[model samples]
Target chain A: MTIAYAYGPNPWPQSFWDARAAANFVCGGAGAGLVVAAALSGARGTALVVPLLAGLAIVACGLAAVFAEIGRPLRAANVVRNPATSWMTREAIVAPLLFACGVAGAFGSLAFVATAAALALAFVYCQGRMVHAARGIPAWRAPQVPWLFVATGMAEGLGLWLALAAFLELRSARVAGWLGVAIIARYVIFRIYRRGLGRALAAAPARALDAAGRALLWGGTLAPLVLLAIAAAVRTQPWAPWLLLAAGLCAALFGAWLKATLVLRAGHTQGYTLPALPVRGTRA
Target chain B: MTRWAMVADLRRCVGCQTCTAACRHANATPPGVQWRRVLDVEVGEFPDVKRVFLPVGCQHCDEPPCLDVCPTTATRKRDDGIVTVDYDLCLGCGYCAVACPYQARHRTPRAVFAYGGAPAKHEAKRHDPARIAVATKCTFCVERIDSGTAQGLTPGVDPEATPACVNSCLSGALAFGDLDDPGSNVSQLLRENRHFRMHAELGTGPGFYYLWDKALPEAAQ
Candidate 1:
């Protein structure tokens, strides 16, 4: 039978992990980043509650998507069995603790919120490692993949916070400044990742990542940075908060877009390559 | 101590896919899944071209990436060095599938018949519900190996004990035996001819070896 996916020098898009898998990375990373962003922004008590709970909810949603993706949902607990080697196991173990701190911080103290943020960071790190563990997928196994995930998660959270700040009526210019800084950092890391990847990726995903990189620069990075700058200049204006919200939305949404692209579009399996071909006439 | 391995004399493989057919008949894998298949690769320019029929499947690497990445501990390597999966324990998360560089692992969401509609009588009878939505792959005929050994038969020498693919090969391209046993057929072949393991630089220490040349000696091997 002619297979849709041919194992050859040219890599083929992997069919195993699909949109549901991408949803986990997208939602999970954003949620983890939001917690870290709130913590770094010095969100305390009442200020911490909204973002913390929201972040936790996002994380839960991501986990739920993953649960739905697995073949044997009843045996899902088995995923936690190999924490010693599998990063997915580590993520599962940490998820509940992260949720615990998130809930406690919702009605408890700032320390709980801070604890939640630390755990969130750990969860995101596990996600990065999880993707990296797929050695058969060349796009995922890059050493910088974990770093990219961590950076994107934090950026998404901070952006969400900046956007949420407008509604909370507890807007801070300092937080906006931090979001800008985070955006710059994320963009830098993304560039480095792409550069390191060079032409290693298959043609299709390489083009996709390049396109994402471009969008990330204009929509995810520069546009948001410019909006933040403009919003800061007109801080007293009635429409200033809206611009801040827009910038935050742009940053957060684009981070998600990047994650989605990486997971879904760039998930190409490592195709076969032979160092040397056997001569047809040879015999031992 | 018996490290089960296979040696593919690449020159001898005709790319006729007799092994592939035998494997499918033995395993009863689904329509899209081919646990053992040959990759016909052409090298060099058009005029100077040469083709090599590479028999590729689960390498059964010593340091199996699939085993380490399996979240549910479903994939395990045996003492005799055969990697097998416990379908009951597997969540079919596909992590191991993607972790395997050989692309040896496979998972299907449901029972897909060879024909479009309802399953044929034989297909329905052979359908393993436990295998549904779980990772499956070439087992190297572990059942045959274990049972045959219990019956006092050596795997490589005994037809009943050997893998169906090895037994079915018309070209005598495929050889299987204990790599640790230097006097074994595979070991003897390796000792006589230069060979290379696929993706060896990845430190997988693949159980599959390909003998490419007789002109090259054991020193090159």
Candidate 2:
């Protein structure tokens, strides 16, 4: 559907926040999710160490991606100055705290584990608000976006946990159960988020986003759940661990794809508008 | 203690785009980056069509969303209500660009010219290396306003102190003045004409006011 705007199309450049920005969202969200899942599972030794290190590395890479995106990377420390208003500032402030706690937690400190989990959640929430604060983009301005990010982050984290478990030959019903719950929550929240976006966006962008959302639901959300269900049913079989691994891979990739689309494709500036006047004319 | 404002009289404006040219010449902005441009809006069907030219740029709002979202504190609204960007502080993250509903902010990472090639002598002379990769927008001719006011001349009354867009307007559609002063040209114009601001519901309290030709039927009585 070709939607006609009264004030013409957006004159400014499209893709203001490009692939690099999308990478930031994908990595940061998944990393924070993994940290939270690790804290919750109480998986000690190699199990905890692997996921924690992987999560932190991904987040650090995301930060580097953002640094590369800025014109002046040398003056990036200025982002920490404005926590009272800017969400980007808040995210910068929380990231170091999250990393510190995660490192301390790895050394058998229960207090650090709890703190890391809390900080991870806060970091995820801050990323969500960063997108939400982009008031020009109708797709990002929805109130549900922040919550959607949180749900997807948790789901992605659980998916990473399962993948690590499968690789390490560690099988735990508690982790699988939590993964199921996280997937369900993410799926539900995504539905709500997509619906809100459809209403808020113009017809053309909305239709395109709707198709992306459907793909995510079927391939990302439901596929993972079905694989996990098969894993649960064939617990005694040799292929059960493989199925869990497949499900984990599917969920993590889906979360990454969703974040990429949100930041890169759905990110559109607010088209121009004229005052309410009864006029019948197309934009020149 | 002056609040800067602009009044674009729709009745007088002819879509010549002189204001756009004047702004470009004065600022020496690169290609594809227009700080000020007149939007040619054609209203009504072809049989009874009426073309209206709307001049648009940074509204310099009292409560600018761009200022609120700037992580580096680069965007700031001055005491006189003209919104400005500190190029040195801006990281060119484009957050302020995304926050502005007006789509006024722009970022040009690379240098490009009208004729293409190495930067022209004038372009190179005018270009500020600090401005590259940072957000840029209309400043309402702050340099002229400051210098002219310092010399004890009124902004709207004196052509030297006024913005290039307002000064170069051929049809005299654009008016710049202190809105806080009742005796100011913009204040008097506002009091006399039925003017409307774009996206007033956003609560940005935009300084740009478009003067309508006739009062609305509901507002007439």
Per-prediction TM-score of chain B? Answer: 0.96, 0.95
Task: Compute the lDDT of residue A129 as modeled in candidate 1.
Answer: 95
TM-scores of chain A across the candidates, in order, are 0.95, 0.91
Residue-level lDDT tens digits of model 1 in A1-284 = 12354666557888888889999999998999888877777767667788888899999999999899888899998999998899999999999999998898778766787889899999999999999989888888888899889888887888898888889876668778878888899899899989888888889999889888899999999999999989989999988988888998898899899989998899888787777677666573
Candidate 2: pairs in clash: none
Docking class of 2: acceptable
lDDT of 2 by residue, A1-284 (tens): 11122234343324457788888888888898888888777878877778887888878888889888887778898898778899999999999999999898887676888799899999999999998888777778788889988887888887887888787887657777887888788878888888666665766566657777786788778898899888888899987988888888788888777777777777766666666432222111
Lowest lDDT 10-residue stretch of candidate 2 chain A: A1-10
- CA deviation > 4 Å runs, candidate 2: A1-13, A277-284, B43-50, B216-221
lDDT of 2 by residue, B105-177 (tens): 8887766666766787888889777777888999999999999999999998999999999999998789999
DockQ of each: 0.70, 0.46
* CAPRI tier of model 1: medium
Give candidate 2's error at residue B111 in angstroms.
2.6
On TM-score, the candidate that comes out on top is 1
